[model samples]
Target: MSLPVLTHCPYCSLQCGMTVAARAEDDGGGWEVEGANFPTNRGGLCEKGRSSAELLAHPDRLTTPLVRDSRREPFREATWDEALDRVATALRDTQQRYGADAAGLFGGGGMTNEKAYQAGKFVRVALRSASIDYNGRFCMSSAAAAATKAFGVDRGMPFPLADIARADTVLLVGSNPGDTMPPAMRWFAAGRERGATHLVVDPRYTASAAAADVHLQPVPGTDLALANGLLHLAIKHRLVDTAYVAERTTGWDAVRRAMRQYWPDRVERITGVPVRVMERAVRLLAESRATMILSGRGAEQHAHGSDTALAWINLALALGLPGRPYSGWATMTGQGNGQGGREHGQKADQLPGYRMLADPAARAHVAAVWGVDPDELPRPGVSAYEMLDRLGTDGGVRALMVMASNVVVSAPRADHVRERLGALDLLVVSDLFLSETAALADVVLPCTQWAEEEGTMTNVEGRVLRRRRAVEAPDGVRSDLDVLADLAGRLGRGQYFSADPQTVFDELRRASAGGKADYAGISWARIEAERGVFWPCPDEDHPGTPRMFRGAGEGAERSSTRGYFATPDGRARFHVVHHREPAETPDGEYPYRLTTGRSRAHYQSGTQTRRTKALLDAEPEPVVEIHPDLAARLGVADGADVLLRSRRGRARMRARLASTIRADTVFAPFHWAGEQTINALTNPALDPASRMPEFKVCAVDITAAPAGEDTTA
Candidate 1:
């Protein structure tokens, strides 16, 4: 037997380290998983991580490519050459018929940095298409936008996860790490044991909230007001760090004036949190010597997520948090490679190294590396939702190539996304499983799974970890790199892509050098030797940056002082924002507010996790969590079937009555597909700044299912 290969989990951004040992031919051709003593998880793994290897041997795992003659026909097994030729020909023909913008490329956050970089380059150079975007736009775009506007850089967590354990207090806003990222809870547990206090702010008393020293359950979509209220109290109580604000930040006067309207009583009326609770929450953060403020999708999936995040950042600035040890603002990225995916080029408006596509210097630098003319590179395209919305319309995206994403089950207002996808002339998807989106494709390319692939992923803490291939993939299956190379070769652009991960990664390093997310110093060998390496490691002798903004002045190793910001003036800017109602709200027709989130056992779309027997058994199906009072009023009992009707669509699932959620709201997980797809009822109204759909808040009404009705539908 061979020794286990060290790797990271293929789940959330936690990227918990694990070792996978391949089984013998007689014992089943998969792998066994065990935890590794990495900094993030510290030898601990979540349920999804432990059972992730099961996907390698899943019976339904796609091992061969599937293709169809037309949209009216069923899929049939096809040769690799046939599939590649078909895809290339469709893309070329689409571009010839329509413009280059008509051939769109959609990527996933789960893709490694190497694949993401190559994919972006392939679309721009090979297809010469400007319409490219990924699912990360839906994950943390608002936080990313806010961070760039404030700090001029957009690393998800400016400080390492270890800082959480060293803080005196942590104010978790709109996040439930206990369920989404179980291994992350250990940091908070250690902090609590060391006399640190945790304050959770969420409408539902989530698992993270239940363990907090104080839980501020506010009304949904009012987090911005709540944050302003906290800042107002901190200022009134004489807790403002005047020196820090005056020296390190700009635009505080405008913010101070804006906080006047969010007094405790007015904030209480808006957020539904008691004035006393808001005051206590503010004091806990202000009095602490060091505090860390963290937020997740709950604060970033609304119509005003950018403003909401800015409000939180303003509160942190008021308490003098940024640039201090164990004190700063961060966002918990949800996907496995979300941090790196956006930084590289999967985003619509970015080139390699987190550089803007519209910048001439950035385009020239990357174009030189790719050996392409700077003028040949296309301009930035529409965002994820906008690109999806334009599909099949006149002069819109006619052909789409999807990589590693299940948009039908994951995108907001998925019913409309499904319709738009159906209207496409050509739909191509590459995935390990036949997801709901793949089921509607003209061609489905089977790709290698995590254990059977070698690549790199950046974690939530900005640490880039390596994933090594532990088991041989099934015969006839190919890596996404191989697929891309084959398609490029078919399109007469073979020199740009390589099937080898190391070669691709070396090229990615060269492409990312001297840019915001510089990784020229990091390599596979260094990662294997050091466990992981953070970015901004610009040279061979330079040490990796674990914490950002560490330096006190100019010319320092990691400067946080004035004149260091990426802005024109080199100072952090603050935005003054006020609360606004969500795009959709409860009304007479749809009287209950509906919110969606992830469950502990299942990841997004449930494509891979649903195939695992152990994970499926844990959370077999979707259920709408409703407050007991609302359930009683609707004449529904626990486990009773209910039909949730929104203005967009309807979903049928079992009711789970609980007091943890608010009486006027309902919660449902967005992992299932078909009639149980909760995203079908979600609001797709995009945030003006981030273009993120409001998945957290929508209006819906619930009614008990009729007798003999199929609740699963």
Candidate 2:
């Protein structure tokens, strides 16, 4: 019998380590997943991870390339050469006729570091297009902006996931680890065993909130006010770490003055949370020896997400939580490789190494490695939503190439994005299945799945890991790296692209050297020997950094006071932020607030999870979650069909009478397509700083659907 292959889960940022092994022929001839001892999960995995092996040989797995001359025509099976040639011809024709920026590239946060890096290079060096972005713009961009503004550098969790167990108090802002990263809940349990205070702030009483020592149920989009109110109480009760603030941070005085207007009573009026609850939260944070605060997509997927995240960071800074052994502020990255995907480029404004594309030094360094002149690289492009919103318009992208992401069911304003896609001159998609977006593509390329590819992915802690291939891909399928290399050769940029994972990663390390998210010291051999290595490791002799922002003499990356932070002066900056209502709020016409999120049974867009029989059985379809009081008021019964309408569009879903949700708000899971897509009713208002769409809050009204109305449309 062959030994089991070691790898990480393909869903979520936790990336739990697991092993896949083939069963004996006498038994069922299938593969099974078993949890492995890893730092993040500690030999534990969720239902998704356990059933992930089903995707390896699913019946719907794409095995051949598909192409069609027009959207109205049916897809025809084609050879790799024909498909690549067709895609290249469309990209070339679009660029030649409409200009370089007319051909755009859209990527995903779930892609491996090598794939993400190559995509960034392909768009710049091959297509020479200034229109490229990824779905991560909708996920972690807000937390990234906030962290960069506060700490000068952004890693999902600057310390590590295991640090949660060491903290004496944990405050979670809109983070639901119980339903999301179920394995990580062990740390919360461990902390509780030691008398740690667990506090949660959310609009819904989620699984994580239910287990918390205190749950602050605030109104939707009032996170900024809730954070500021906690700070107000901290200052009023003399809980501020004055000495630490004076020594390690700047701009606190301005922030302190800004909090004068955020008194407990005023915050209660805005957030619907009581003043006593706010005071208790502040006291718990102050009294604990070590405190940690973490935010999630619920907190970062709003129009004011950046400031809301910054306000939480300000509270942590005021309490002197960062840089401590077991205390700090961090964001829970959602996608499988969200941390590394953005770090190694494939983002709108960033080059490899987390360097801004507009930075001349970065451009020169990357250009030299890529064998191109700095001038050949295109300028920074528009963001994800803007790129989608401008498709086929004048001065906008005429052709788009998508990789790893299913944007049709996931993007904000689902109906509008679908329309823009339909208007494109050419649409190309590379995925393992015909996702909602792929169905509209002019060419659909079958790509290798996780178990059939070998690459690297960075986890939530910024540690880089190896994903080893366990099984052979179908005869007709190819790895994404191979596809990129072939496509680049067809585009006359053959010398710059490599199909080998190691080669691509080596180039990435060189391009990322001397930059913020440095990987110069990390090697594949080292990763195997050490399980995984953290980033900012500058040289072979340097130990990879797991914790950052220490004082002088700690390490090279963690240098003296003058270099404590990544900013110009090395001091952490405090953002003086104020609360603002969401871009769209409930009113007389639309009297209920709408929020969307993931269901534990499925991942993003339901691309893979929905295809798995076990998971599909767990959650058969999308449903609208409403409080019992709200359902009663609307004369809706449990399991009743309801239609929700927003300014953008409408969706029909089943009503779930859940008391865990607020009476004034309704929730929906955005993991379906067609009429059940919750994003169809979502607002696309972008955050000024992060450009994040207001997916967490919008105004909507719901009514019972007419009898026998087709909700599946």
In TM-score terms, which candidate is top?
2
**Can you list the residue pairs that collide in candidate 2?**
none
Error of 1 at 141 (Å): 0.5
lDDT of 1 by residue, 153-184 (tens): 88899878988999999999999999999999
Q: For candidate 1, report its TM-score.
A: 0.98
**Shift in Å, residue 171, candidate 2:** 0.5
Model 1 ranges off by over 4 Å: 24-29, 553-557, 560-564, 708-713
| lDDT (Cα, 0-100) at 351 in candidate 1 | 96
Error of 2 at 326 (Å): 0.2
TM-score of each predicted structure versus truth: 0.98, 0.99
TM-score of 2: 0.99
What lDDT does the true structure give each of the candidates? 0.90, 0.91
lDDT of 1: 0.90
